[model samples]
Each structure stands twice: as C-alpha cells, then as structure tokens.
Target: MNLNELRDRAYKTACDHGFHDEELSNEHCLCLVISELMEAVEADRKGRFAKVPVDKKDTIFDERTFHYQNKYFAENFEAYIKDCVEDELADAAIRLLDLCGLRKIDIEDFTEEMLYGAEESCNDETFTESVYAISTIPIRYEYEYDYPLGGQLNSMLLAIFGLAKHLDIDLIWHINQKMRYNDLRENKHGKKY
Candidate 1:
C-alpha cells in the first residue's frame, strides 16, 4: 500500500483501540506512522540491541594480533555494519518519539498494528523485493517494481514522530540527527563487498 493508505489504516486502528479522538487524530497518526517507518526500533534498553564498536589495535597484546591469524576476521566487518545500523538507526526512531512527547502508553497502543505488519513481512520473499535487494531483481525489467519491505522501519519512525507532535512534543532536532546518522558510509572503498 502507498504511505497514505498505510497511514489511514494506522490512524483508524489507533482510534478503535480507545485513544482519545484528538489523540489518534491525523496528527497523532503521523507520529505512529514514523514509528512504523522505523520498525527496527525496539523498546529494549538492554544491550541486546546492536553494540557499537571502535577498532583498537594493541601490539603489546599478542592475543589481539592473533585474531587475524584465524579466518574469522572477516566476520568483524559484518558485525560492525550491523552495529552501525542497529545502534544509530533504531535509536533515532525511539529518541525522536520520546523527544516529541510520545508517552510509553501512547507508543504501546498506537504502534502495535504497524509493528505487527512489519514483523510479519520480515521474510525472504519480501526482503527479496527490497530496495537494497538487488540480487533478487530479475534481469528482465518488464515488471514494475516497488519496495514493500525496504522501509518498514522508516514508516514506524514517521508514525512515532507524528504522534509525538500530537502529544505536544517537538522533535525537529532529533530528526535532523537521525538524517545525519543514516547518511553514513554505505560503500566500502576496499576489501569485501
């Protein structure tokens, strides 16, 4: 569905769940939409969310240098990428909502539908059609293409931010920070693809 349709459904669903009429109104729906956009954002405060790591080399510790001797060194790069995405991207959505005045209760009630839809669609087939899923794109270009799976997290983020405004919170500052974080390095100049 297009963004507008998803938005309408989310708002309607929130209203049905007993939020105040004005609370789940168009403005609030927009915040929920942002949360839906950033479905990767988890409410967990635990370190379970991806951990950011900085490269540190200590020649004095032979053990540190010994890691490269094993074939598993490449895996660290993968972990680094995952950490960058999980740490910065997901946190941005949550912080934006919080900054915008989205109460924990507000997020709980309004975010279920969006989050559920996103979680359900997290499958190989859906991912194969994603924007970054170029490998799944067929050589033939006759068929039209759309990214139903690529931006669920982004949708969640939008939903929450919109809802925050309804709660009387302004999150322009947080949103800007998120934009900067997301624009970080996407391509490698050397080594692995």
Candidate 2:
C-alpha cells in the first residue's frame, strides 16, 4: 500500500490497540515518539535487535517480561539484533503516523513536502546539514497554530523519515510487521511500554 494507506492503517492499528482511547496532548505524543527513538538509540548501543520469542506460547509482551528470555529469541537472532536501529526507527514512524491520524493531518502531503525540502537543502550540504535545515520547518507552525506542538510533531516526523532513509529501511514493511507483532501482544500491547 501507499504512504497514505499506510498512515490510515497505522492509525487504525493504534486505535484498535487503544492508543486513541484518550485524547493525548501534542506534547505527550511527541514524547511517545521520542521515547521510541531513545529506545532505538539504546538498542544500537547494546547491539540489540527486535526478536520474537521462540516459544510463542510463553511470550509475554509486558515490559517486565519482554526481555526475560534472550536465550529463546527466534531464529536469525543475530540479524534481527543488528536491525534494532531500523526497527526502532520504524516504531518512531508508526508513532508519528498514529499521531497524524489522530490530528487529522495530511501526513502524506507533509512528508512529501519535507522530503523535497530535504533534497533541495542537500544540494550543497551534507545529509546532516539537510536534516538540521529541515528541522527548522516546524518553527512556522509553532507560533502560528493554536496547537503549537504541531510544529514539534512535524519536525519529529521529518527527522524520522530522514533517519529511515539513511538506514535503508522500508518503513511501510517494518510498520506492518511491527503492527502484526503488536497484535499478538496481550491486550494489543496494552500497558507494555
């Protein structure tokens, strides 16, 4: 499916998982996204990757039990561990998509605009420079919009996309896989974070 379709699906998945049960403030959403990014950073630091338990019946998605059975990690454990950064990056995008869906933002359009802007900025600059430049795009919304957090949210989404590109991650596929795994979590990943 296309980006918009993916966004819709991501949003629906979040709702199905009870992420939309309460009205979260923009700052809260931003924090949630950032937390995922931090998790990615931590995963990278420890050379960790996302893995399913070998014994699916014994798996518990709760945070407390999530990492209790490293020995029973699924096959290709090494490869999956190496992909921790990418997995976390996908998670960040998933969070952003869910937020956009909740806010009724046209994420596909914004993503296109930001990506083009990033490309243009990279013509005479490094990728890092381009990302820094793109990060500033949210300033306009910060003051002009009633929901000032929109700017922050947009900036985070842009950065996530940029990182995904750098990491060669197919966010659509990762999001789909992550969501499917999430679905298998008890109560749809409820209280797991």
The TM-score leader among the candidates is 2
Cα RMSD to native, each candidate?
17.9, 8.2
lDDT of 2 by residue, 1-193 (tens): 3556666777888888777777778767767776777777676677664554434364443334434243332233334533476677777778887887788776544556676564344567543444344344455456656435544665666666655555445555566656555554454365843
Model 1 ranges with Cα > 4 A deviation: 1-83, 102-105, 110-116, 124-193
The lowest-lDDT stretch of 10 consecutive residues in candidate 1 is: 131-140
For model 2, the local distance difference test gives: 0.60
Clashes of each: 28, 1
Candidate 1 lDDT, 43-119, residue by residue in tens: 22233333322223443213354243444433543354233324333344533243233222232333546544444
Query: Clash number for model 2?
Result: 1
Stretches off by above 4 angstroms in model 2 are: 49-83, 109-152
